[model samples]
Target: MQRKVDPEGLAAAAFLAFLATAGLFYVNIMAAIVDGLVSGLAFTDAQAGQVAAVNTYGAAFGAAVSIFTIARFDWRKTSILCLVILVAIDLLSILSTTPMTMIGIRTLHGLVGGLLIGTGMGVIGRTANPDRSFGMLLFVQFGLGGLGVMFLPRLVPLYGVAPLFLSLALFSLVTLCMMPFLPDYPPRSVAAPIKKAGTVQWTPLVLAISALFLFQAANMGLLAYIFRLGTESGLSRDMTSGALGLATWVALAGPLLVMVLGRRFGRFPLLLAGMLLTLGGNALFHWSQFGEVYLLANCATGITWGLVVPYLFGMTAEFDGTGRTAAAASVISKLGLASGPLVASMMLGGGAGFAELINTALAALVLAMLLMLPPAIMLDRSARRPSELLPQGKVTA
Candidate 1:
């Protein structure tokens, strides 16, 4: 029998997913935060990159830990504790004077942030439709994230970076109030062992996860330097922020498009198209001197990101019914995210132009596209196999 949809459960899951993935949203406004640190605390470009990288490193660790520990605890309580810790940590970040200090604080923050995100993914995995649930989750994230990107530059100039940290803490505090509505654990069937345990395939799972990591790395590599790139292209801080905001708003169409279409088109086709769009966007950034071109590039990349993430998450869930593979995929993806800015910084050294950043990201995207193709073919073939069909006509590779 088809399961009944729980409206309240869906709402709680979407809200928690938004709050849990705060780190992802933080990245959207990170350029402003890095600028504030540079101006207020005398941080170098490399130091700023370190600050961004450390958080993702910590998040990778947290996600790994979640793979082992998430099944042991109640997600509601776990989320609350994580949020409380995040609030305290964000407040303490205000006192960080040196790059090392900031790195330590952000790394610790990422650990808890990763746990929240993993838990949220776990919740989404338990839903009637993981794809639609994740789509809603991203919708909330991008909608609010867009607003933050739009306003953060103005706020940073007027009130400095301290307000940004404080605002995040405040948001966490508000999200804490909604914990009562969320499920403590996934449904029993979702947590049950697979009937054909030892017969489970691993090759496609590894390929998909690897592809996701590369895709995210390429995306973040460029994103981490967006502010610098924009400024170098002769755009003002407000203009850059506005462009990102518009791009973020445009990204909303991605998940909504998926939700409405809902498997009418196969995942690989959409995934390939999104990847190509993102690659083209990266190329545009490399050649374009005008702010409008940059803004259009951001829009394309944002839309692609939105379209790709849910399917990636769904792939992981399909690979492992218990959600461990999804959690592991999160770890890999977070590590890639951590590495992106570090790699970009290394390429930049002391000072590099927007072209260099674009070139580096383009290379990463090309590699990701290549790696993704094999798995896309494998997944599409598996979907078409007669024996691989589930009861509802869903394909399980």
Candidate 2:
């Protein structure tokens, strides 16, 4: 007998996916904003870097808040409120003439964006196949981000950065209409286990969370500077944008690949392979002098990112029964992303070039590789256990 697909679940996942795109718009367009601020507002690189970082900082705080209070409100209504605030802040961002004001406004925007992300994650986490749900989320994020990277640069030359902000606001407003389709809360089976927090395992959970933070910090640290790297490598603006866009689209393949494989080879092997691929990609970026080689490096890194992120989030969900840990992991992940650009900016201070950026990325990748080892070991050990003997969420392949 064929099982019927749940329209509500599919709708909810689509909403969460779009929410992911809207939530990440600022980061995806960071390069353009930096250029705009430096040219339009006459700000220094450090100042522009702060403008980019504050949004993620605010998101970290908002995710923390959501971790504790998410169960108290209706997800649909909460999302609507967050979306409205996001639109308001994105619009207000255009009025800032000073870095301090831009930071202040962006901070507020990040908070709301974080809340939306947490809310969406909460909804998607409750679904039966979180791996696939998160894959959908990444697919939407990269797909839309690719489009933005491809076109936003062209728009920037004509209309400047205000339109980019406005476009994001408009996108959020559109997502608001999808809120009605999302689930109000997780399933009772998933939510009712809140009192068992005392019994939750801490070691693996902590390791997994740490791995996520380090990996993102490493990935975003490099990615935050990819546009700069392209230009420094002698690519024209249009060529750089095209490379970024193409890489993002290529990244979509990672999640789709995960979906097709579906635990066939187990998580540890896939995770390890993804990390190794990331290292190689960074190496390629470091060595490549030609524009085409640099773009290929982008594609390599994109594929690596697509391959790993879902499993990391899935592992977090597996470790915690109540989903608070997953929410906390989101916070940590955002903090890593927020820190990445700041770290890159500091490294690139006063006319440093691609060598500095590549070196920093390599260092970060090494640290991420180290942090991932313990979790991979744990997953490997768990995969050896009999299916009936395994804990509820510990079943790997």
| Among all candidates shown, the one with the greatest lDDT | 2
Best by TM-score: 1
Candidate 2 has an lDDT of: 0.74
Evaluate candidate 2 by giving its C-alpha RMSD to the native, one decimal: 4.1
TM-scores for all candidates: the values are: 0.88, 0.88
* Backbone clashes in model 1, listed as residue pairs: none
Question: Once model 2 is optimally superposed onto the true structure by TM-score, how far is the C-alpha of residue 275 displaced, in angstroms?
Answer: 1.6
lDDT of 2 at 358: 81
Per-model CA lDDT versus the true structure: 0.73, 0.74
